[model samples]
Target: MAILIPFGLKMQAQNNTSGNKILVVYFSHTKNTKEIATQIQQLTGADLFELVPSRDYTTDYQALIEQAKKEINADYKPPLKNNLQGIDQYDVIFVGSPNWWNTFAPPVATFLTSHDFSGKTIVPFITHEGSRMGRSEADMKKLCPKATFLKGLPIRGSSVKEAKPLVERWLREIGVMK
Candidate 1:
């Protein structure tokens, strides 16, 4: 079951076990992270929560780069359009983001800080152009100190559609999927 939240954010229900309540939360600018999040959801039967920014980023490549650099340098966390509810019910969270300036996007940082994930297991995944994983895992670990961090999967942005096998393998390796 998928619930359509305000601002076009969709949350999908997990139809698996009740013990391991899973949530896949992500911030996707170019849809690469979104694609990976969808694959993870399929494999684990997890819920989906998309982080939509209140302010939309520019579509121009150079402009987007400049904006990202400015935000990262300032350590800015843009406001999210919709806030997620019932986050405490999840035990495992899969966080995905595009690699921006060797780190996760600013909006992902916002989402992390907004929620309290004291005892949840966090599995990170990144879609990068060339800088694989970048500093995303480290950054996330810093933000979510109390959560258990798993080995992250980094896929090239251009090859996201072909990433099902890799994503499945990582899920199995992490013991999220059998």
Candidate 2:
């Protein structure tokens, strides 16, 4: 008999061990961040968790922009559908999100505040059209003040599939891979 795993729970794990537990947590609006997160998980052998919002965003681009802008201006934190269990088990965390209005999506912020990241290493990655990393790193630092922040990677959302080499280079630069 074969065991079937649900798609959401199928986190990738490799045999490589660096003596540090790692987790890749991300919020993908258009699957761009999700793609990057998957690549990071494969490279670092980290567990993966997706940030799902209690309320869904619109699929329409213009509408999303309006909603995001409103939320950002209001400093809103949307409730999350699930919380990261066993968060203390990880020593290094890769937080990924799609850049929205020069910052991370509100759901990502919600996730960041929901955990205690003291002494953990936070490596940020963002997907953007032209804004690059935006204020994501700074914003995350504020939320996770006790966590060590590493240099971030920003990829063009449209070209996420070609981001493997870039991601690999970033992992080495951040000292996550030797």
Candidate 3:
């Protein structure tokens, strides 16, 4: 079962072997992305923060797609309902988002741009139908030029509920778990 860890809550991880403070920030329109975020926390003991827009996106799939497409075409970054503080304290950030319009959701753009990730590391995790990472990784690099990125994880949205093992393996492969 996916843990319903509240967004923005800081939970001390049990196995922070790297000794670097870590945070998981994500934008989940559906719960698929959130489920992956929860798994990352369970594996690495990272804190969780949800990215919420000041205005929620429409629930209708077609409407949301059109909305996302327009936002991406314009390179828009919507205002977030909440933003993290003391961002400089975290050494690594696991950024999660649904692959929307071939990119990370707009709120993710705001979150990445709003912080100074210079000298920091970003571990990207994306959920998608079939687009996979699409242009999201490329766009993320543009958003945070100074941040170092590990290889990203792209899970099929339908497979998320069965993904704990995959998630654990990914953490080990990335050297986040050793």
lDDT of each: 0.86, 0.85, 0.87
- Model 3 lDDT-worst window of ten: 1-10
Give one digit per residue, the lDDT tens place, for model 2 in 1-178: 1112233223333422456878888999899999999888878777788889988899999999999999988989998877777789789889999999999999998989888999999999999999999999999999999999989999999999999999988888777776
**Which sections of candidate 1 miss by over 4 Å?**
1-18
lDDT of 3 by residue, 15-65 (tens): 566878888999999989999998898778787888989998999989999
> All candidates' TM-scores?
0.90, 0.91, 0.92
lDDT of 2: 0.85
In model 3, pairs of residues that clash are none
Give the range where candidate 2 is weakest over 10 consecutive residues by summed lDDT.
Answer: 1-10
Query: How many clashes in each candidate?
Result: 0, 0, 0
lDDT score of residue 151 within candidate 3: 91
